[model samples]
Structures are given as structure tokens and as C-alpha cells.
Target: MGVDQNSIWNLHNKLPSFPTLNKNEQTEVLIVGGGITGLLTAYELINIGLKVMVIDASTLCSGTTGRTTAKISAQHGILYDSIIQSSGVEQARQYYTAAMDGKDRILNILEELKMDIDIEQKDSVIYTEYDENIQAIEDEFRAYDTLNIPGKYTETTELPVETKAAVTMFHQAQFDPLLYIKQIIDVSIKQGLEVYEHTQAIDIEHGNEIKVTTDKGHEIHCTYVVQATHFPFFDPLGMFTTRLIPERSFIYAGKNENPHLKGMHLSNDTPARSIRTAKINNEHAILIGGEGYVVGKNKSSADPYKQLKQTAYTLFPDHTFISQWSAQDYNTMDSIPYIGRLKNKYENIFVATGFKKWGMTTSATAAVLIKDLIQKRQNPNENLFSPSRFELTSSVPTFVKQNSHVATQLIKGKVSDEGKSIDELKANDATTLFKKGKKLGVYKDEQEVVHVVDTTCTHLGCEVEWNTYDLTWDCPCHGSRYTYTGKVIEGPAKKHLKKEEL
Candidate 1:
């Protein structure tokens, strides 16, 4: 299944195209990703009188930032109690403060730039259906109160489904992320920051001056490099491979009752549902999201599209269905994003990733932290999310569990072949039929060109499913995506699948 168009936030709006890097370039700061983190970091640095350049494998916002739920909130699903219990009261408090202040900073930027990004302050809520989790919810609320965070506890919710209890945080927000990013990109360009699309940074050598080589043969020499690629492109120093795991989530959008719910909402339980609204061409649209799982795992026996449609109908029977889409996110084992310096082993290189589905707020927070570090300023939240911090207790177990799951999937997928022909495929259609003992992906585009790629996801060897809406091969387990020709369009899969000879 592919992403639904209606749920996409203001993507129809046009922005200037960024030229691809074709020659050698030098800058004071080189940002190796053009998503929210990279663009915002460049925007901030340019304002502070630093020469900045941003390079992307594809276009801006085409990565996880473009596919996010776009909720800007301090309330990250049932985390305060867990963090306070595990990391101590001060650490949890600092985390909450950083996230809350990040939301404020977004609003401030919107106002300062007078950008119309559909920014709205709606209370954020986290609810759960299981009554057994009510005590956990209450405990989280108590922790919030103890930290003096502006939040409240409630036993009832406005959701179509019933819930045991919910924790509401005031002054949280939702917005059209693309619009916000467009404004920032424009400002960055005006401030003399350079952005290059279709520029894939293939290698990075760290020193007093960082050297970045692009697939297109362009070279970048810079005093500093920031890897905002969601998962660090360079993993040797950060151990991002061991620290973070990728997950996939689905979203469905359609028209709903007049102002369905007043605020943005998410659940505190597994298979979580998130709700938010947007105005598309003067019409209101509702986005309901759930059905998440780790990469490569098939949670449903039925078709994902049918499942999403049925779920939406169950929640809003009278509303008209518009569009549906899915997004991939990286979840850190410790629930904190890895920000600041890359690691103790590498200097002059930095990274910001592992937002755990809260990238909208956390990405902004990362920009602030990275910008501070680049310009030699100070930020209190830097150490809390530092990449060097190691929790061996949790890290070891997480590493084992993740790798074991991957190995299991890889071994289980070595089955026999059953081929299907391109003549039988329909437009915007895909299938995982076998061809000559090799599992092959078959996708027919709107133009009727048949695309053939290996069905195996380059990340973790999970079988890739056809997402008809997005016209990409989607890894059901970890949310990695590839162009029909087997190009690595998304990651934690940094490498593309080897193209199978037809």
C-alpha cells in the first residue's frame, strides 16, 4: 500500500528546485541531508554568518520529514514516567523542558517569519484503551506535575473509541511541515546558504576539515559536517546501527465530521493511533494513523489498504475517504534522540537522529543543538541526547534482539520461486511474484512502464511489499523504501539492492 494523498500536509505547494552539486565546493559547514534537520541547521547557521551547504540524495523533505505525522508536541506517548524511573528525575525533566521549548521555538519562528504553515496550538493528548495501563498513565501524569510541566489528567476522551484515561498537555501544536520547511529553505537560500538536491554523499573522512564525496563525483571540503540523514550515514563512531531500530507506521486520510476533535491525539498503547486535521483547498481533512510494526514483519493477513479503509470507516463511518500513506521512523532503544557531536571518536562531525516517531519536534530541537555546537554556543540539552552516552544494560539487549530478528527474517525468506509477468500488472500496481528462483518486485507506473527490482529489502533482508500509492517497494518490517529499480531511496538501508538480471 502507498501513502494517501489527502493526509499529506500542504505538499501541493510549490517551492524552488535546488540545483545538484556538479563540482567541488567548500563551505564552513556542510550538512549531509536536506530534510528538516539539515535545512533548519543551515538556516540557523546562515543567519549567524556561517557559510553553509546542504546536500540531499533526492529533493528536500522527501525523506522521513515529508512523511511525518507533523505533530509538534512535548507529549511523546507515555515517556515521562519511564524516563524518570530509568534515567532519574533531573534527566527526565531536562528532556521534557527541551521538547516543550522546541515547540515554542517553532511557533516563534513561524511568527517571526510570518509563514503561513497552518500552525495551530491544540492540546496534545495520549490515551490508551487498556484499563490495566491506567495506573501507568496516572504515574506519568504525576511525574509531569512533579516536573511542573503544564499538563492534566483525564479519564475520558473525545475519540470515537472509548479509552480508560488520557494525559493532556496544553499548548502543543500541529502544522503543515512542508510549508514550514519551505519557508526555512527560502530564508536559508536568501541568507547565502547553498542547497543541492540529487547529491548523495557517498563517503565522509573526518579531520580538521571534513571531506565528503558525492556519487556524482562532486567533492565537498568543509570545516564541519552534520549528518542529519535520520540514521547517521556514517556509523563507525556513533554505533547508530546498534543504538537505533527502524519501524513502519500507516496513515489514512479522509473528510470527517465538522471539526471532529479539538486537538491532536495519540494512544499510549501498541498499535497506536494518531489523529490530526488539516485544511486542503478550503476543505477540512482528517488524518488517522495506526497499524505500526517493526520493519519486515507482516502484522495483518489482509491487504493493508483494505485494512486502513476499514479502520477509518469504523472510526468515521459518515466521512468520505480521501487518501492514505505510510511513514518510517527510527526509534532509539533509550527513548532519547542521539544528537550533538557524532561521538567521542570523531570530532568536527555531528549527527541528529533517533526521534522515535516524534521527529517533528525533535528535529527542530536537533537543529537548535547542532547550530549551537557548530557556532561554539551552549545548550543545556546537548549532553542529554549526546551520541557518546552509552547505556550498556539496555544497549546490549536491544542489539541482540534487533539483530536476532533480522537474522530470523533473512533465513525464513529463502523460499522457492513462482514468477508473474509484467503484462498482467495494472497501473500503480505491484506484486512479490518470483522469477527464475529469485523473488522479484513488479511495479507498473502511471505511464505503464514496468519496473522490476529484487523484492528483498537491502536493510535486514526483509521482503519488500508494493506500495501502490507511493509507487515504491516498502519494507513491511522496518519501513525502508527503494525505487522500483532497487535504488536505496530511504534508510537505515544506506545501500541499494543489487539489480537482478532479468
Candidate 2:
């Protein structure tokens, strides 16, 4: 069978379709993204008799929402220990509470819909393959204990490997994410949600009212706006780009006589190891994820998917690679996600992102928090996740580290060695070369057709590096991704990379 390059969730499910915006329209709420977060928020407001419209750059839920391993749990690696130390115990408890609330909301929806999507209640575990990481696990478990969370510390887990120690959170769940999204779309549409696909919200003009301009020149005038795009595509304060860090992780899924994970398991090791199973349409596949790297940090010839697959079989022995894909997620400067309103000035515009790869649980909470904000209700957790509330101590170090690395990447990309000229470029490969001091990316197709684009990242003038694994040009600075043809895929960069003159 040919390996599918998309998330295993895409199989046997077709999402409800919507049209591209053709003309200016008005609504009470305008959601710029049609993914899980946006849709959940839309459903909440629409159910309360508010006019809500959702727009997506491409198909709904086609971004990070579709590409997840779909572990709907509150356990996000060894996170609580750091959060408790950085913030307070109350703040840490609030974070845990919000995550659990989000997880419960997902389950409640599934029960209300009574749909079967291979939902399984399983314990979620964090283990360490190395001795160095065991202390981190012990600290996290202690944090969990202090927070009154249901968890236990152990010396090892159920995975077929040697481990220093582990931590387990009981009764977390997993399912086919896309299937659940399909049901959410159904429930949302019934609540009178207007959705627009292939309609990109490009610019936001905030005056007496908020007006969102799309790529098609159509505008959405609304009382409130929500930027639910994985990264805030429109940042007025220029804060999000600096505050958020993007990383990419790979997943390999296939059939095995015995799946490695009895429960969803993650190793607390660098570059991480995540394992889960997806049983859909009576077909069972074990998914092994995590050979990850920060965007544009290590751009070389090696493929992450191959490494993940090789690692899978070495551990599972009977692992068969049926499908493979990659997912990109953003981590905030602090451990907590930046939910709630975008800024004090733009109070009418709310934003929810920086899930830290735990969106299945976090996105649901974000939706509810955004709804409370819109309805003028006070949510206790609002201040904790506010995008504008920057903790100097927790965030400043990350901020300095991220921007310094950005500085290094920006300067490094300019002075680095020029790659092979167009004639010397290999078929079905890509490179960056300098011609007349103009850095350009060159890609030769299977048919030997040469395509070139200016390697300058449109977001902040940083250089774009060729990512062989995803076959896209990635900005080492802020995680803007583009096609070999130079079309914008993921962004902080809204514009397509300019084609070079060759």
C-alpha cells in the first residue's frame, strides 16, 4: 500500500463543506480559523443566539487540528513542575482544572452525539528512557500530588523498552480526532454557524467596529473577532511572533499484532517519544510519534519520518509502516497557553493558541474561555491565560533565547555557503544559492523542471531553509512554512515567497 502523507484521522471521513466568502457580510462574531478551537467557540456563541461566522484559509480543521495524535488528556509531558515553580500553586491548579474541564467537555459532546469513533478510555503515562530525566518525572509527579491530580509515580511503564521511571495519569482518552471533528461540525451547523472555506482573513481593521479583510477582497464586519489560527496570523502588537515558538513532530502509524502502548505513552526524553493507537472502521493501527525539532533549527538531508519509522520497528519488532505524517505546534514562552483576548486595546478581538502540542484538551477550554469573554461573564482562569499578561521572569528568558536564536538565524542565513547552481542541482531536490548576492531557493522536479524563489522570509526578512522531511521551505526564525512553489503553507508570513528571476 502507498504510504499516506497525511494524519491517519483523514481516512474514511469527509467533513462538511462551505463556500468561500464572495461579498462583505456582517455578524456578531467573526472567527478567522475554522479549526477545532474556532468551531467550538463558534458553536458556543451561536448556541447562545449570537450570529457567528467562521472562515478558514483552506478546508476546515485542515491545519494542526487534523494532524494530531489525538490524545485527549490533561497530561502535557513533564510540564506542571516548571509551571508551579514559575507561577504559583494556585495558577498551576487553575491550569490543570482548565485542562480537565476541556477533556470533560469533549467527552460530554461525544455522549450527546452518541457517535462511535473508536473512543477508548486509557491511562496516560510519562516515562523516561534516560536516568537524567527521572528526576524531572519525580518532580512532575510531586507537582501533581500537590495539585490533587490523580496520578502515580512508578519505576517503569508498559512499553517494550528499558526505562528509568514513569508517571501515570488515570482515565484519559483517545479517539479518531477527525471523526469527532466531523460530529462537532454537524452539531455546530445545526446551531446556525456560517462557515467559509478557502477564505483567508488577511487584515483586521479595528475602529468603532472590527472589519476583517480576506484574500478575495471580501470583508467581514463584526462586533467581535477571534484569531484562532494556529499562530496568530494578524498580530497588531507584534507580540505573538516573539512570544511563541514553533516545533515540528513526526508520526508513523501501521498495524501490529500487539500495539506497544496499552495506554497513551510519552517518553520524557529529548526529541520525545509518543505512542498511541487508532482503531477506525474496524482497522487498527499503532501510531508512534516524536522525532521532533524546532522549526529550521536543524535543516539537513535526513528525514524525520524515516527515523520515526525505523525507531518504531526497532522497538515494536512487528511494526509495519502503513502511513506517515508530521504535525507543527507552538509553545508559549511560559508553559501555559495564551488564551483569552488578544490585547487590552483590541478588547473585541480574542485569540487562542500556543497549545504546546496538547490542543485536544486545551482547545476546548480555550473555546469556553473565549465564549465567557464575549458574553461579558467572568471566568476565573481568564487572567492566567491572557495573551497580554506577560510574566517577566517565566517568559523573559525564553524571549531572550528565542529572539537571540532568531538573530543568529537571520545573520547566519545571509553569510552561509551558496549551494550548487541551478545546472548542478539534483532532480527532485532543493537548495539555497546566492546569485548576485540575492539568496534564492531552487527546486528541481522529477521531470527536471527548475523552480526558484527568493529565500528571504516575508515575515521578518530572515532566511528560509529547505526542510527535506516536510518538503517545504521553513523559516528558521518564526516557523513560517512555504511550498517549493513558494505558496504560503503555515505562517506568521501571509504573503507567498516571491519567485526568483533565475
Q: Of the candidates shown, which would achieve the greatest TM-score relative to the real structure?
A: 2
lDDT of 1 at 367: 84
lDDT of 1 by residue, 242-333 (tens): 56777777787888666657789888776677888776667777778877777656555555556667767776778797767777788887
lDDT of 2: 0.85
Clash totals in order: 13, 0
Residues 1-502, candidate 2: write the lDDT tens digits: 1112677777557898899889999999999898889988887788778999999998998888888888999998888888899888988888889999999988887877787665799999999989888899999999989998998999978777888999999889998888888888887788788899999988998888998999999888999999999899888898798888998888888877746366899988876889887777776688889988888777544667777787788777775767788878999889688998866668899889999899988888988898899889999889989888868878888899999999999999998845566777777778888889898899887789888999999999999988766668899898998988899888688889999877
Winning candidate number (lDDT): 2
Please list all clashing residue pairs in model 2, or write none if there are none.
none
The CA lDDT of each predicted structure is 0.78, 0.85
lDDT value for model 1: 0.78
Which stretch of 10 consecutive residues in model 1 shows the poorest summed lDDT? 1-10
